[model samples]
Target chain A: MEILIIILLPIICTIMIAAVGRKSVFLRNLFVLIPTVGDFLLVGHLAWQVKSGGTAASLNLVDLSNFAIKFEASGISVYMALSMTFLWIMTAIYSFGYMEHEHAQVRYYAALVLNLAAAMGIVFASNLVTFFIFFELLTIAVYPLVVHEETDAAYLAGKVYGVYLLTGGAMVLMATVVLYCLTGTFDFVPGGIPALAQQSTFMLTVLFVLFTIGFGFKAALVPLCYWLPEAMIAPTPISAVLHAVAVVNVGVFGFVRVIYNIFGPTLYNKMGFGSVIAVMAAITILYSAFQGLRQKEIKRMLAMSTINQLSFMLLGLVSFSMIGMTGGLLHIYYHSFMKITLFYCAGAIITQSKNKYVANMGGLAKHMPITMTCFAVAAVGIVGLPPVAGWVSKWYMMQGFLEMGKPIYAIIFLLSSLIELGFFGPPIFRAFFRKEENNSFNFQQDTSKFGSEAPWAMLAPIVIVAFFSVLFGFWGFVPHGLVKPALSGLLGKGF
Target chain B: MITNSWLLFFAVFIPLVSAPLSLIFSDKVSNRFTALSNVVNFLVIAGMYSAVSHGKLLVLELNTGFNFKLSFMADSLSLLCGLIFIAVWTLTSFYSIGYMSHEHAQRRYNLFSLLSLAGTLGVVFTRNLFSLYIFFEILSVASYVMVVHEESFEARKAGLKYILMGIIGGLTLLLAMVCTYHITGTVDLL
Candidate 1:
């Protein structure tokens, strides 16, 4: 029953928001907050239950002899769901301030809510069929948000986003069909299906390539990263929620499920897939950081940063060791906090000051002290500084690399930290140190007040998420709690 | 909160929590405050040393998710480290009262010295690599201010090099811990 409602509620709320929005704008806004908040609670509750030795809810629909659609809140499912819905709540609350002047409120809210259901579906899926279905739905759901402005540029970005993802979807669907035929099952198992090891090596290799290409596109691994920065043509809210938080994460989560659930680390290790992924993710980490440094636009730089950061999680997943996997999985939770906070600040800055480039953001901190301060905190976290969430995960990732005897990946991670500083530092330095000539922007003091400096709505989520990034760093129980259980359960290792 | 080991927290955190307090008080008051806190801190650990020396294993565990607790164990080894840290801390509190009188930025020195003491005690009491790493990081970071406390040109450069080595050391320790955890499937020390 809990599983049914968890899956069904988002669609129900999306329909309600679309219908109620036509009658009252206030109701529409209220409706927008309900589903994400509710989803977060439901998902978080499921995570707690599963962590405390309760079996997660599993559901099946249209059972057709090994081809049924199934949803199960396994440890990793709850891991992804908890973070997605939590950030979804932030995005929902944030849009109230950021999207006030934007066009098409009804369509935006409806699509945003639907994206939540799709994300929840992808995470909770018990089979390749269910995972693929939700994965494709997420692609279609985010299109409206992608080309939200309906501008030529938005349309162009929409086309790139669609073309890249749809082609990847085709590859994944092909892989799923082949996998089901080879294994006579569509259900996902923690650690690869034992029967897969019996298949011909050549066939398994082909299937592996298909799944990698499919997930790698959305994961924004090097060659496929062009669409990510292209999609920056969308509004900052979409950039933050779908692009930074949800859409891209779904891609890495796919890599995670495939590595652990589908392929099993033993087979992944035997096939030398860790080395393959380490190379690809390593390339993406370096190349995208360089790309990020070249981008003059704030959101574009963040997009490049997202592409770089996503691979960090991807790299952790294939670390071929539990510790590496732990670091990678923890990163999925931690990066959302750091990256989303950054997007909120970037969006808030763009909206209030009309300054989008790094150079022009000089002395913007004096205007929006709260936003810039949060930006600096998140920037420090991204740089892997201690007592911020990013350091813990990166510390683990570095260890995972060393544990696997792949110190090269560890070196790559360290190099990215410096590059992260390079890309994130200039904006912060310019914001605080560089002077804005003829500055006329209203200075917002007393960050505690409502509607101060970019509206309480936007400021609140930015500050709260930033605070959690710090909290998760110091409060060992909160972020680390869920991840270790989830990863241990997946690896079948009792900690 | 586990057992009667609540005083273990006071041993480490009293020094930590009292750090910023020096900024508010004058030199004499700050000196007295530091002395009082360190004496209290020493007593907390010294009292535990009696039980610990008898192999009582004054264990305190804070729930940190999974089945893994952030357990603080004061066996003979940790009690020894704890006693030594707080003892030195207590001695310095008196010594610095006069030592800091002629020093510029005495409050700043007082503040970081207190912070580093707690960080050291936390390192001493932790039963696992993860908790030790946390306190070790704080200690390393807190020591940087003292490295540059003199505010001279050489002090700044030496401070930079000191912190760079500290960060590298921290990263190396983290790598070793990860390797240990990967093999053991737990961050705890046996």
Candidate 2:
């Protein structure tokens, strides 16, 4: 019953806002505020329950014996749900003022709500079919938000986004159907399909390929990563949410789900696929970091960085060790906060100074100290510096890799970290140290002559997220009581 | 038996109710009304989630053209997806206040967006291959309107391509569904 309310609240809000938006601004804003607060409370309650060792709730649809729409908050799911809701509240607060000057405000708000709802659903789903349904819906829900600008560039970007994700969705759907056909059920029980291992090795390998390609597209592993960079044409807020928090996170989260829930650690170890996955992830981490170095566009650089960071999670997953899985899970939260902070700063610079290239950002630290400081902190975190959230996860990832007796993977991990630092460190260094170019201040003054910083509405969320990025690191906590046990249930003691 | 199936009716009717209600009102009034309907619909979903979270099953059955019953089930997986849909829709609504303010055909966009929600939820709740296909098509068609909301030549082109590709995908899915049904003698998902 609680699960139904969580799902229904937003749909009701959408209807109310769409209806009220045309007539009364007060009513429109009121309708939007009510549900945002409600959802936050609802998720908070669920988190508290999970923390108290209470079992998460599951709602089964009775009309269909074979079909069940469920909601269960395991440690992992609760963590993800809480993180999403937290960021969303901030994004909502940011959008209230950011959209004030924009046209077509109603559509923008509606899409935002729809995307949030879809993201939450992805976190809570317990089966492959249910997850796939929301996964595809997420792609659809985010498209309008991407193309909200209605420009030719936005359209083209939207097309690329559609093609990449839909093709990936097709692959996932096919694999899901095949898996369901072979197995009687599609539930994500831990320890994977034992019957699957008994099948022909050739069939298992084929299934593995299909699953990797499907999951990899969202995870942005090398070959399928172009869409992410292209997707940067979206509005700054949309970019922050989709690239930094929601859309990309779903992909990595799905990867975790597949590995921990569907494949199970013992089955994964027996198949000898962990080495293959590890190598693939290592290559992506190094490749994307190098690519980040060559890019001039700040958003593009960040996009590439996301591709690299996501691989860290994948590497942890394939590590087949406890430390590795924990590190991977920790990275999800760590990376989300850090990346969102960077994106917020990027958006601030662009919105305030009309500059998109890093080359033009000299001496920004002097003019927009708050934003630049936040950017620097986030960059440091991304580089895996101490006292920031990123290091905790990166350390665990390294430990996991080393524990597996794969010293070479540990070397690759360290080398990739250095490469990450190599690309990310320079931009912050240049932004603060370099003398302002003659043309640099021209654009900065042209757009933001009225003020050197973005509105409080925008700045506030960045500051909050940046603070949490550091704070979570200082705490050095991984809320694994919920997820770890659930994972144990799925993977057995081998995990 | 039919009366006990209120959950199924609520699942389908909550958002579906908004379409006619939205269309009936004047453009300005209908938009607000549609927003209200969406809010109400989402509230109903929240209630459904509550029911499910309490360890109850929210299921409904509808008669199909062929002597078949279309089943809709609310389990943890679907509830999760449903939660996300409602949440994102809520935020997007706030965003749309600013985004859709100036569009000429505001009513049309609002209507289709709500219908898209209905179709999305329909897909989330349904239990069989056949219903999944039906709702999937509905979602595809409804969202196509949103893709072409601007009605520019470029928007139209994109929409056409999207529709065509969707049709191809749908046909492929239909073929797959038929194959499954042939093999199993029923299209049940579980």
A1-495: candidate 2 lDDT, tens digit per residue: 666666677778778878888788888777666666777788878878876778777765432555656656665676777777778777777777667777888887777777767877788787887788888988998898878889999899999999999988888898888777676566777667656666666766776777888878889988999999989988777888887788888988877777767766676677777777888888898899889889999999999999998998888877877767777877888888899899888988887777889888876765676788799878867866534576656656666766677756656655666566666755665565455677565343433423577789889998999998877654543344444654554475544
TM-scores across all candidates?
A: 0.81, 0.70
lDDT of 1: 0.82
In Å, residue A73's CA in model 1 sits off its true spot by 1.9
The list of candidate 1 runs beyond 4 A from truth reads: A433-452, A488-495, B1-8, B11-63, B66-129, B135-173, B176-190
**Candidate 2 TM-score to native:** 0.70
Model 2 misplacement above 4 A: A442-450, A478-483, A489-495, B1-190
Candidate 2 local accuracy as lDDT? 0.74
Backbone clash total for model 2 is 93
Q: Over the stretch A134-241, how does candidate 1's per-residue lDDT look in tens digits?
A: 999999999998899899998999999999999999999999999988998877777777789889889989988999999888999888778999998877888888
* TM-score between model 1 and native: 0.81
